[model samples]
Target: MIGHVGFTVVVIILKKEDTMRITGISSKPPLLFTPLFPTYFFPTHSDRKDENTWINIHYVEQIKPLKDKKCKVIFVDDQTITVNISAHSMHHQYLNGIYYYYMMDRAARVATFDPDSPIDYTKPQLNIYEALAKYSLFEHK
Candidate 1:
């Protein structure tokens, strides 16, 4: 189990999944349920195995810093919650979630790319190939 906070429980049944290899996130990685619509949920605390709140990165509207290194997070639906973490840290986590989503989406695209399929010259894909090579993403092959 990932953890349980309040009434919410997160459990991953997959065994020895390489989340870092697939998502490029080393710590406190956001959870992505579906690749069709990539929405990431990030933990409020550092440890994922601890009792911490998980917030959807897409729904966060604003983060207000409070005293004692805590912050209040406001959602797009006007719901708010006070978390025991600094606003800076919360914002950094939010950015990390976005980065994780981008990497996942890119990986999906790369995996689905067919060498035999006709390329769309109108939309150039050379840069993506170059970036993958530079990062050694295809080195294992």
Candidate 2:
């Protein structure tokens, strides 16, 4: 899939394995969390004064479908991260994904992910797939 973010286009080719049910727990709470969408750091309301200034703004500038590789992203609401991802879009996806996991894990200080269940993005059985669909890394190809 070709991920278009601003003036950049990121071509991501994911094997079926890459898109499989690979799960990971956040070692600690995320350094940043969106005030609006409390489950994720996207679509964050900028007016919220408590949001952390994420190390680099590029980690979530674009939303794309990453299949079933969804992970448990923890949010502690009290701390920030040490390392940051690059702002450039030309970076490789494998490296970027690794860094993404690392940053989230390192920043978290609240809880570990539960491996027994798939993360249900829909709110309380609301089944709002459309609403939760906006949090991807690429659009479905």
Candidate 3:
């Protein structure tokens, strides 16, 4: 819009307004589900075996993306087990991201990640924080 004030000219530009957004990027879709906390608990009806570990995880305890990026993290909360994944945005088509390894202690809702080993998808992941927010260690934090 443009208006005239005496001999001066004034212009106004307008932009659309949307509130359901994380930072400047709209959360339309494509929120990747990756684990944040990696805790190890003995699987039921299973025996302890090798020290070799698989990588498939099942839940996201804390979600931390780049301050200005839209990427979302899905991880479980463990005592000493943790996974460190590095990515650019909160949204992507998968594989266009980067990830490394970390140690964690608690187990949340996650399947498991095996970069070099086979996994049983028929099993269910368990995320207790999400199930019991009030009881979660991160309740107020």
Top lDDT: which candidate number? 1
**Model 3 — which ten-residue stretch has the worst lDDT?**
11-20
Clashing pairs in 1: none
Per-residue lDDT for 1-141 in model 3, tens only?
A: 434642231110000011112113222211212233322121111112333222232343433454343333444555333223233322221211121111112211222322333222234854343334212322223
**If both were scored by lDDT, which would come out higher, candidate 1 or candidate 2?**
1
Q: What is the C-alpha lDDT of each candidate?
A: 0.64, 0.28, 0.25
CA lDDT of 118 in candidate 1? 31
lDDT of 1 by residue, 16-96 (tens): 033455566666766655433434778787554465787888899999999999999999999999998899989988887
**All candidates' TM-scores?**
0.63, 0.20, 0.16
Superposed by TM-score, candidate 1 places the C-alpha of residue 136 at a distance from the truth, in angstroms, of 18
- Report the Cα lDDT for residue 95, model 1: 85
Better of 1 and 2 by TM-score: 1
lDDT of 2 by residue, 17-134 (tens): 1222122312211222321132222212121335423222334333223324322222344333321223222123323344544333332211222333333434565333322332
Compared with the true structure, the alpha-carbon lDDT of candidate 2 equals 0.28
For all predictions, the C-alpha RMSD in Å is: 8.3, 18.4, 21.3
Q: Sorted by lDDT, highest first, which candidate order results?
A: 1, 2, 3
